[model samples]
Target: MFLPNPDAEFTGSYERCGLTLKEYQELIKLSLDSRTFLVKQSKQSAFAKLDLYGFKDEMVFLSGSSDNIELLHEIMADYGEDVNQWYQPFTSRIRHIRAMKSQSQYHTQTQTDVFEIA
Candidate 1:
């Protein structure tokens, strides 16, 4: 699961990921400060293109393995109740994405080819 800064200037025009800039920064700081393996901060840059309308110079990204719900829970525990407000929406999006992926996979058809040798 990946979360971007909601308060980021460019984020307003696009889908919000439910995290404030302060919260996003703090999360990254926490991981760095503690040198924990559960979470890591990544910096991403988006280039302007005709197809992409919203582009940010530098974006903060935080992610944990899809199977690792504990990573998110641990962060929430550290941040206390304040994080609960945005947690639901964030997790909801993740669940929705997962559902979509599973549905697509179920509906997709696969083809195999065989060759005969003389």
Candidate 2:
């Protein structure tokens, strides 16, 4: 699910399929620490509020990051399972993700609200 992070300045998370919250958070941290998003800026930082979810018989990853939110959203929007589809943009800038319940034609708000509004 798309959980709000109270610790970090910006909220983000990327959970792996079939893993617990702690495990997925660790993996996301590892990926972020090692993965560089902006070469001009400091090396990639970590994501926040990592969690897990499932669709049908298989599990899917859910995560958020200021640098990678759009990427994550695009990935889920295009390739993620429909039942498990979910995304919540923190703002017009940063995006958040969880599990989606609906797939109808809808317009997203510019707020950090992390729920679907049709």
lDDT of 1 by residue, 9-95 (tens): 525532264544544454444322232222223434222212222322111114355444554555466556575564665465566
Clash pairs detected, candidate 1: none
RMSD of 1: 17.9
Candidate 2 Cα lDDT to native: 0.36
User: Which candidate gets the maximum lDDT versus the true structure?
Assistant: 1
Task: Return the clash pairs for model 2, or none.
Answer: 12-48, 12-64, 13-63, 13-64, 14-63, 85-100, 86-100
Error of 1 at 98 (Å): 0.4
lDDT scores of the candidates, listed in order: 0.44, 0.36
lDDT of 2 by residue, 1-89 (tens): 22223342222323222334553444434433343221111333343432333332123223333545555566566657453453332
Instruction: Give the Cα error of residue 95 in candidate 2, in Å.
Output: 19
